[model samples]
Target: MMSKNTQADRNPPADKTAGQTKPRGKGKKYLVGLPITVWLVLIIIVPILIMFATSFYKKVGSNIEPIFNFGNYAKFFTDSIYIPIFFKTLLLALAVSISSIVLGYPLAYLVSRKVKRFRNQLYMLILVPLWVSYLVRIVAWRAILGRGGVLNTLLLDLHLIKEPISLFIYNPFAIFIVLTHISLPFVFISIFTSLEKIPKNLINAAADLGANGPRTLKEIIIPLSMPGVLSGFTMAFVTALGDYIIPQQLGGPNGLMFGNLIVSQFGYAYNWPLGAALGFIMFGIAVLILTLSNKASASEGYLE
Candidate 1:
């Protein structure tokens, strides 16, 4: 009976379809991803490929010649004017990023740790500015900061100034203020998310060890939250660097950024190849920033 059972088990009752079917989830995932994959390829990957390819070509009169050369990047390096603007843009972006962290961190802490009941309300308020049109906001800032506008009128009414001041709009200071304000909410959201995920037991453990508020924050909270802060900085810096509309709206010739140079190449200058080259360089820089930040975060995590 045991030998018969063993032989029957080894022979196995086989339905004709026993190992013929494929896994079920693979088909579903492929179908779900098909549209998105196509969209990404057409809209993103294809354009990037075209841009990179175009960057290698030469623009002659109204036409682009298929002459592969590094002249575009070379021109950017050789020109002293654009080179200084690039450095200045880097500095400006850094300043905006740092300012966002400084301004957003306390606000994030207040919402996440202090305001427990109405934290959602606080976050919504932080994001309220995003609901407004960016162009509209810039226009509004122009009105508020313009000569003989809201600020000047208020100052005049308060008898604080002799006449309208042109210090608020059409300058580097205005661009910095606008960019920092625009970036603040994003920075706050990132920090608040990180701060919220911190283990309460760690804080309590430190407190039990006679560590005061500031000391505990310095040693525990800051170390844990540094990842979020770096992320916020990198995002803010990238946004600031890529901005062209704000600079055009509020910046004079003297306050122009690297974006304007790229714009000029594409626009009236009619040099699409050079514009593509500049864009690729910007992309490379952004990728480098993300790579460095990721490496640092990984190293910090390992050390901790």
Candidate 2:
């Protein structure tokens, strides 16, 4: 009995330290993550909460009152001008997403699958625009689309017309063009990454089974790349939806987007409550798009 008791004391139990160790490790992990959690709360959560609360506040004669009401939200639905602009913005954003995908997918496919040499150079060229200032890119577009810009000069030199066309700038088409250019890189990157991740062995196997390039692409590559396509679509849609600068700069009279409307409420309109409501509506739409994209990505992963 004495020997057995001594042995038991020496061994104790395996779980004795296991529980302590696991909890200690978890506690350390939590402690390490605490700063990130705090940062997100302070930067993101706090601001969103503040905006949400402010959305319910009353805007009384250029000053915002702390009074809680649903007037701002109601005003959005009740206002005729707001709803039409919102729908128009939605259609424009959708068009931008489609255009980005159409333009970007070919470039991404060429870079990922077709190109052998100068691939890195091409990739860098694609991303180089992102390094430039956003406003600079907008200004560059203005310069190109402006009356005396390169297009007009080229057209004049070619004798396509006697004069430069004013149709290029300060129109809905100009807005579409600029937004597509801005969004193309993001879509290309997403699709390129997806294409790169496709296992070479799978393609070889398809070839071994006598599958042609087009068939393999249609059956395998395109389906696998759906996640990236969806992700890129979401990014383009969100970027175009919330952009006021491009619309304001290029949209002229017909260029007033939902984002411009929201900005107007905050800037010149002096209606903080209404602005917050509009901003939150946009934020919700972005969140919804992201959520859907994530789910689609996950579903694709599961199928793969």
Candidate 3:
């Protein structure tokens, strides 16, 4: 009669073979992920590092020579023009993000809460605008907002205004309008995904607990969907901050953003060093906002 321990060792667990006791082979797994890891390092990480390195350098004469100097960053900080523009751009992006969220949340909720049969159709409708060319959308808005344009004609026909509003095209308002339209879809999609994750039983349970519509939405829905809202806002904010095309085309003098200024430095001004520094500053702001958002979300237990 063998002892219990001796018998157990003789017949080990079915899931653990003698070979299984040894370390598993990591070779195949690493090989599978190696290509993607390499691509990301080469394409994304390397470029970011290069940009960071270039930010510390200054341009010399008309040549493409970069002299290691902090003057570019110093100029950005001390120069009244750049600092104010940076703040203004940040403010504008925040406004756009807020506006997009405000407009997107309700639409997303409505679509998400609808019957399954209708949900797909509604989602497609919302996404249809994404298929359209961004440039075409901006140009269409330009035509509608231009003097003697559709809006002006309609208002004139209604005798609402004595003359076409000159403030519509080539203005900050135009830039805001275009940016909002472009960003609305991103917010809507993000919020919709979050709304969809919510179990119907939880909502039913809320109702069973005598929770009213407003109370349930405020206490349950909003908190659960906060992650999506934050993500959408971050995406829209960052994109709007770095937007060059819409502002360049629709914006007149007043509509010019920091992105436009950065582009000018790299292009016409031939000040690559200053441009790199400004780009790095923008990167810093984006990182700070994202980090703060992450911390806040984590504190709220919504970062999972």
C-alpha lDDT of all candidate models, in order = 0.84, 0.88, 0.83
Worst 10 residues of 3 by lDDT: 1-10
Off by over 4 Å in 2: 1-24, 302-304
- Over the stretch 152-241, how does candidate 1's per-residue lDDT look in tens digits? 999999999998998888899989999998899889888887788666866787789899999888877777777788888888999999
Question: Best TM-score goes to which candidate?
Answer: 2
The alpha-carbon lDDT assigned to residue 88 of candidate 2 equals: 95
lDDT score for residue 40 of model 2: 100
Instruction: Encode model 3's per-residue lDDT on 162-223: one tens digit a residue.
Output: 98988888988888888999999999999998888765766776789899999889867887
Q: How far out, in Å, is residue 235 in model 1?
A: 0.9
TM-score of each: 0.87, 0.90, 0.87
Worst 10 residues of 2 by lDDT: 1-10
Candidate 1, residue 86: the lDDT equals 88
Instruction: Give the per-residue lDDT of model 2 (tens digit) for 1-304.
Output: 2222323433445557766756456678999899999999999999999999999999887789999999999988998998899989999999999999999998999999999999999999999999999999999998998999989888989999898999999999999999999999999999999888776766776788888999889867887778889999999999999999999999999999999988998767888888999999989989998998999887675222
The per-residue C-alpha lDDT of model 3 at residue 301 equals: 30
Q: What is the C-alpha RMSD of each candidate to the true structure, in Å?
A: 11.4, 10.6, 9.2
